[model samples]
Target: MASIHIPTLMLALLSGFAMLGVQLWAAQRSRLRYLDLAVWTWGSWTLLAGFAMLTARVVVPVWVSALLGNGLIALGIVFYNEAIHRHVLGRALPRWMWWSAPTVAWALTAWMLTWPLAVRTSAISLVFALLLCPAILVLLGPGWRGESSLRAVGLTLVAAAASLLLRSVHALTNPEEYRDLMQSSLGQGLTFLFSFICLIGAGFGFVLANFERIARRMEEMASTDGLTGCLNRMTADALLRHELERGRREGTPLAFVLLDLDHFKDVNDCHGHHAGDDALRAFAAEVRARLRASDVVGRWGGEEFGLVLPATDGPGAARLVEQIREAVATLRLCDGDGHDFTLTVSAGIAVAEPGGQLTADQLFMRADRALYRAKDGGRNNVQLHDSGWELGMESPAA
Candidate 1:
């Protein structure tokens, strides 16, 4: 039996485990947690099983290490597909194709452990390497949008597999010289470097992401209303201007909704300012829940709020704002004593064509006109800034 290279194995194991950690972190981003976590979990399991295969010296045939390593490698690929399904691939592996990856693992494991490992048996290892090639292509496939981390991962895996394949060929071509302590370690060290060292560097992407997420969240808070948890007038207007440019360039539909809490001063006058604050908070929460994820909501200041809905037409904008209006009416916020008071908000919606001539200021002016109409007509309704209504209204246009 070949003795394990203690240092090389230790290094490989550590790097592999570190990569497993990153995989776990990356996996958490998936809306479906288990599907992604399974990849990292299986990867760690493969490493553990590989270690066990190395340590249990007396348990199996001479080539048992190769079989165990290859089997776990194949299992890792199966889970790799799962990760790709949720993350890099942007689609789920089909039921049949998904199951086949596993079926491949099970069958390949049996073959590796039992086969005599003559040149004929080594064919199985070749098959696993081939699978990585296609998996690499899909996992990191090229994009019109340019390169991605998945593509980088695909490149790394492809090169690593190539190194492994070459080393295998080298060993087969010259078995005697490749069988020594120094020789074995050198071959394995190169393989380990190929398989994992480049990826260890890539792990920094996770750290970068973590820091970026933290910074983004902090920036969001700085520009947001603490009580309502929406962007403040300053921030929202800044964002709207940016989006207005995008709307013009992309030729996509955009809508603006300007809203105000009706009789908000009276809520403060009647129930106290604390109640008004609660209403604002409740209003923000309701608006947030009602808007599509693509929609942006912000506190326009002093019981006034605003939204920008991209890729939505006028009708869609109206329906959504009306839904928000109705939802705000039904939402019962409480005072400190836990008394429920139903609140109603008025909304004004304005939409523009893609690359529309309207500036952000123009859009806000239109929406504000609609909002004023809603207020004048009686609150708790959504009004659109049709041709006649657009000329007059308050603007939080910034």
Candidate 2:
């Protein structure tokens, strides 16, 4: 096997990590100010510091290089694991978990000072492997199974862990060959090479993961109402058109409902805008809870919401709307001044039977007209289009 200069490899890794750390720091300062990115940046820099200390092992005191150097390396791995955990699960790891492995690794490194050099090396390698395990579990967890970037990050961590474990075993079996830290042995070369590659892969993988998260958030912001967390008007219109076409092709019925909160302006005027906003969010949640997975709901405008129910007939739509109205009536809300209040919703339902030739606009208009009738018929009622001006069953005042 060929010899590889360990010092040169360390230098290369040091420079690479420094650059990666700087780039990540810059990204965190940019529009992508994610907590994970900040944590990853710190991890890279810590790794850089550890590598720098290790590279200067020939000049620094033995304890500094072996104890502080290895300790920093283990700490850096912990940071990386924490960053992945936060990014994948949107939460921090336990405090004990954060400090436990690194502290043990550092203490073990000190305890092995008088032991064989290879044994010390093996202990540190195992520590690195231990630190990476949690990140791998989090990245491959079921919650993020569909995220390709996270999968890539997880696989990279797997490779790094495998390499570390292999190094630990090799050091134990070939202590003579791993006697010195700066030796020109193939094992040392391969270990550092693996470290270099894994470093680059992990850094890029984290960046990709951050981008994926940002993209998903942007898409959500575009498609959903920020206040109510319901589909926005434009997205709702597009979905309605698509669902209508699907219903026509499949010979299925579809229902469109327009709902408005009764006296919503009075809620704002009497309580405040904050109270009004709370009521809107509560009404949206109630409607969403009553809907099937296949149903779609959107915020049409202030105090108004739209619902699209596929494969639903007039009676089914009317029943669901009535249920939503009753649910709204039961919501106990409070104003900024701690005064309690209640709310009511009026809904208008328009159903398109199988093979009906109703355009999206026409269907929306019919639902809108029905909604107005519900509002005009003394409020807090459900009205169905084509039901011959029959006033819907009016619920008592909230």
lDDT of 1 at 1: 37
Q: What TM-score fits each model?
A: 0.50, 0.93
Residues 1-398, candidate 2: write the lDDT tens digits. Answer: 68888878778788789889888988899965899889998888888888787777889898888777887888888888788878877788778866886688779988888898899888888888878888888877852574578777788888998998999898999898788888888887797579556966888889888888798999999999999999999999999999999999999999999999998889999999999999988888899999999999999999999999999998889888888988889999999899999999898888888978999998998898888878888889998888444355443221
Counting clashing residue pairs in each candidate, in order, gives 0, 0
Candidate 2: lDDT over CA atoms?
0.86
lDDT digits (tens) for residues 100-208 of candidate 1: 6545644665654544333322354355556556556664554212334445556666775676576556556645534432334455445544554443433333233
Error of 2 at 172 (Å): 0.8
Lowest summed lDDT window (length 10), candidate 2: 389-398
Error of 1 at 202 (Å): 6.1
